[model samples]
Target: MRAFLRFKNSLSLAFVAFFATTSLVSSEIADFTAFDVNLTLALLRKDQKIEVVVRDQVTDGCWTKSNAAKTAVEKNLIIAGYENIVPADDNAFFTIEVSALGYDTGGNNCAVYVSLRAISGEADRYYMNDHEVMAINLREQFSSSTLLTGPKSDMTSRINDTLYEKSDELIVAINAARNSLRKKISDTTISEQKKNGLLSAFSLD
Candidate 1:
C-alpha cells in the first residue's frame, strides 16, 4: 500500500511539472511574438511611406463592401499621419496587407474577421539551399473578429470604428518604441557617435 501511494504521488508530481513547462512555453511564445511586433513597429519613421492593400474573402453577399473596407483602412492610416500608398511603390518603407472575411448572419447580424500584416521592404540574408539568399526581413501581424448587429450604415460605421481603433493601437505602440529608443540615446554611457548612428538608423535626425 505504501508503494502504491508513492507511485501515485510521483504521477501527480509529473503532471504538475508537465503543466508548468507547458505554461512557461506558452508565455515564451507570447513574449517572442510581441517582441517581434514591437521591433517591426519601432523601425517605422514619421517620414517613411507605407502601402495598404486590402483583400476581401467574404462570401455571404457582403463582398461588395470590400472597397469600403479598403477606404476605411486608408482613411484611418492617413488620419494617424502615416502616408499610405496603393500598389506598393518602390519608395514604400513598409506594406500593410489587410485581409477581411465577413459573414452576413440572419436578422441583420454580421460576423467579420479582420487581419493586418506589416511587411518591411528591407532585405536581409539567410541561408538556404547551401547558399545565402536575401529577402524582405521584417513582418508582423494582428487579427480579430467580432459580430455586429445593425443597419447597413450602422454596420459600416462599426467596421470603420474598429479600423480606427486598430490604427490608433499601432500608432501608440510605435510611439512607445520611439520613446524607448530616445531613452537609450540619452544614456550617458553610450558614446556620442554611437548615439548619432542610432538616431540616423531611426531617422530621428
Candidate 2:
C-alpha cells in the first residue's frame, strides 16, 4: 500500500512538472509568426481645430516592426509651444499598431498593413495623423475613389486584398477548385467498410 502511494505521488509530481513546462512554453515567443505591437498617437492642431490618427492599418506594405509603427503615431500629441493648463494625456489623441495576426493570409507571407488612427474634435477625427502613417490605411479605407488614378491605382495588390473582396461567384469557384483537390485526398483515405457505409448512407437518403 505504501509503495502504491509513493508511485501515485511521483506521477502527480511528473504531471505538475509537465504542466509547468507547457505553461512557460505557451507564454514565450517560440514562433516568428507571433509578435507584439505598440500603437502611437498622432495628433496635430491648426486653425482652431485638431487632427489625430490612431491604430495602424492592416493592409499590405506597412510598418515592418509593430512597436515602431505604434511609436510613430504618438508623435502627433507633442505640443512644445502651448499655453498652461495642460492635461496629463492631452485630449487630442491617436494610436497606431500592427495587426495581431496580420490580416490572416495563407502562410508566412506578411502583406499586412499597420493601422494608424488619428482623432480630434475637428473635421473627421480619424484622419488627423501625419501623412506617412495615415497614407498607409486611408488609401485602403477609401480605395473606391476614381480620383486616385495614374500608375498607382493600376498596380496589382496582394491576392487577398481584392480576391477575398471579390464577388460570391469567384469565391465559390475558388472553393470548388480547392475542394476538387480535397476529393482526391479523400479518394486515397478510403476503406472497404467505409466505402460500403458511404454508399449505403447516400443511397438510403
Residue lDDT tens for model 1, 44-92:
5455567777776755554445566667767777777776455555546
Candidate 2, residues 1-205, lDDT tens digits: the string is 2332343344334324433433321232211000120001111112112223223344443223444422332332233221122322443221211232233243333433322222212111133455332111221111110111112222123322322232222223324443443343235344555434433432211
How many residue pairs of model 2 clash at the backbone? 34
Residue pairs clashing in model 1 are none
Global lDDT of model 2: 0.27
What stretches of model 2 exceed 4 Å from their correct place? 1-65, 75-89, 93-101, 122-205
Which 10-residue span in candidate 1 carries the lowest summed lDDT? 28-37
Predicted model with the maximum lDDT: 1
lDDT of 2 at 132: 30
The regions of model 1 sitting more than 4 angstroms off are 1-39, 61-64, 89-93, 128-130, 141-153
Which 10 successive residues of model 2 have the least lDDT summed? 32-41
Cα displacement (angstroms), candidate 2, residue 152, comes to: 24
TM-score of each candidate structure, all chains considered together: 0.63, 0.22
